[model samples]
Target: MFDGVHLGHQSIISKLNAISKGKDLESAILTFWPHPRKVFSPSDDLKLLNTIEEKKYLLEKNDLQHLFLKEFDEDFRNLTGEEFVKQVLVNKLKVQHLIIGYDHTFGKNKSGDFSLLKKLGPECGFEVEQVEAVNYKDLNISSTQIRNALSSGEIISANEMLGYNYSITGKVVHGKKIGRTIGYPTANIEVDAIKLLPKKGAYIVDVFVNNTPYKGMLSIGTNPTVEGKLITTEVYILDFNDDIYGEEISVNFRDFLHEEIKFESLEKLIDQLDLDKKRTDEYLF
Candidate 1:
């Protein structure tokens, strides 16, 4: 799905670009949307690294010349390996060359692989190639692994695999006005429902408002110290005091700070907040 477009996906795209340039052919990617798993098993709590819109934005940064998003419906799912090759690759796209990952599979029940592609490529008047997996620190890089890292608040590891800092854009909304009382006003962000969030904790992040970046601290959790129930994503922009209740902002995670903890008293929570601010300032500076 190219969920995160991590190093592995980038490696394959690099190979595709190199070969396409050498052969004077167009480099393209054919990805399915709505995720086949989501269609097949609706009950699965499948958290993705990027939404479809985010995926498109990320892929555009690469050397890809073309991108085709096919809906993963029952009709597309029922196509056999050969049928897909003839209908989609040969007839519709007129694909001259196809590049895939080491373990890529397609068609009905994932019956198509490198071997199947090679077998049909000759008859279909096309070429097929597969790129080996990318590795980091002797471990294979994958979207699932990156998601796992993010789920556990391993920001550094996830960012290393992603080749960029993990970020999310959301609109500022109203909160209970509690932080301001402690001299640390926060912007409560309303994120997309489908966007996968990192583990519940405080993080040192770079906040972008109106495309301008600023250092900030983000908290993602149910505010137990405030006796709050709903999980909220809030950020306190350092040295920023603006009435931006409806403004859109982006938060780029830098590192995990600490887990959310319920303090004994509001005074204790303020002390911890001060410490968090000091640590965040030190790291950011």
Candidate 2:
């Protein structure tokens, strides 16, 4: 229930499993909605790996149950971390242990760090566990790296850490309908949140249309190469045809094929696409 929920966060989950084994107690998690940061500071650069809905799906993949979806509000933010544990976690939920990240912080102004936890644990009737950071090579695995990789069009490296392809979730909406003439009809998805987006370019990806996954190429940009405005995500599903307007679909980028290129002529753009398709097949498959 944290932002990004990166690989390093798995340490907390693993600790929960290690503690829960043979205890016959269900493992649970708690997270906030709309993000405390988003509520505190809204921005245009806000990017997310998964929406709230997608986050729930991801948590379930780890066999996690009892997700306490807390709303971000002044009342919740005002509570001291000790108060939160004493009243909410211990008194209410009867939790015996709390697992947190290596750099975990809580309470108003994040004053309740690990040191405070150690002092208050016996008072609160629970124990605390901290998970060290997980690393890939010398780099400590983090969500920031994943976002940086995607924003720089390093889709392959990003996927390697994520253990799967990177994806964005949005609802399909109307577009200029110009790609039809170019022999590639794309379904445009109108974004409604501050989800993170990849760099402005075309990349080979797997688009999840409903429950079925299709091999495809996605464009995430303001159409700079096409002289069009309005940042959009357009995907062209391959080897299949269907009308998907006004539908919710996710676009999962698998590999970075090439950067967004501007052509002097539409014919030139089409020719480049032909090579992109060929490379996409070889790299993605």
Candidate 3:
């Protein structure tokens, strides 16, 4: 899967699992790394729903027997539709049956399709099956849709499509210590460069530290109130305080609180934060 591996992907994978079980075959996912988009446009600002590690973890949870991760580069991108099937699917994987998404395409110049796979399946000694798209709110569920929802600050809709809460995993970093002065200490998060972030705003989130969940208010934006231009993500965990710098954590976006605003003063910012905390408490509890 390219990104989120949302419900549509899960449907295909679930079909693969059922088919594999019925036919006494092993199931595996053949996914590419470095994303094809990143390969074609090296400098493009491409963000992904899940990092490689995150994708691996999710796939493992689905009880996949094997994960065939291929590094995508210039050479890999040049392979023809036939070469990919012959060299990779048939020879390497010995795949007896292939389950693909309805709109799935592969090979050089995106030439491969379900029809090509079906035509070649008999010759290659394999079966080809395609899973129909899953729809939510009359819209086809896709990584792009989820990404767009998140970019627009529609966390609830994004989570609904994902079949899980949208989250970001990162390491806690040091910040300018501004929140502390305002009586709300925060943990600055340093996330993966390629990881897709939700819209810049404040959110009601659940912070996962050492496998424990803590309610928190997350901020994602430039500190306009402080006249700072650098975009930062920080979380103020409620009812908890301890040094956690350098520790890895994950923040699950539960609800959108409000947009980032430039308060007139620090006092105004604190006052807004108090309201934010109250809203978060009401939502969480």
- Top of the candidates by TM-score: 3
What is the full ranking by TM-score, best candidate first? 3, 1, 2
Clashing pairs in 1: none
List candidate 3 segments past 4 Å from native.
none
In order, what lDDT does every prediction score? 0.90, 0.78, 0.92
TM-score of each: 0.97, 0.92, 0.98
Specify the poorest-scoring 10-residue window by lDDT in model 2. Answer: 37-46
Name the top lDDT candidate: 3
**Clashes found in each candidate (C-alpha, N, C closer than 3 A):** 0, 2, 0
Give Cα distance to truth, residue 274, candidate 1, Å: 0.9
lDDT of 1 by residue, 16-109 (tens): 8898899998888888788888999989888788878889988887968999999989999999888899999999999998888888888887
What's every prediction's RMSD, in angstroms? 1.2, 1.9, 0.9
lDDT of 3 at 79: 95
For model 2, residues 212-263, the per-residue Cα lDDT tens digits are 9888888877766579877788888887688888788887778776777768
Candidate 2 segments whose C-alpha is farther than 4 A from its true place: 43-45
Stretches off by above 4 angstroms in model 1 are: none
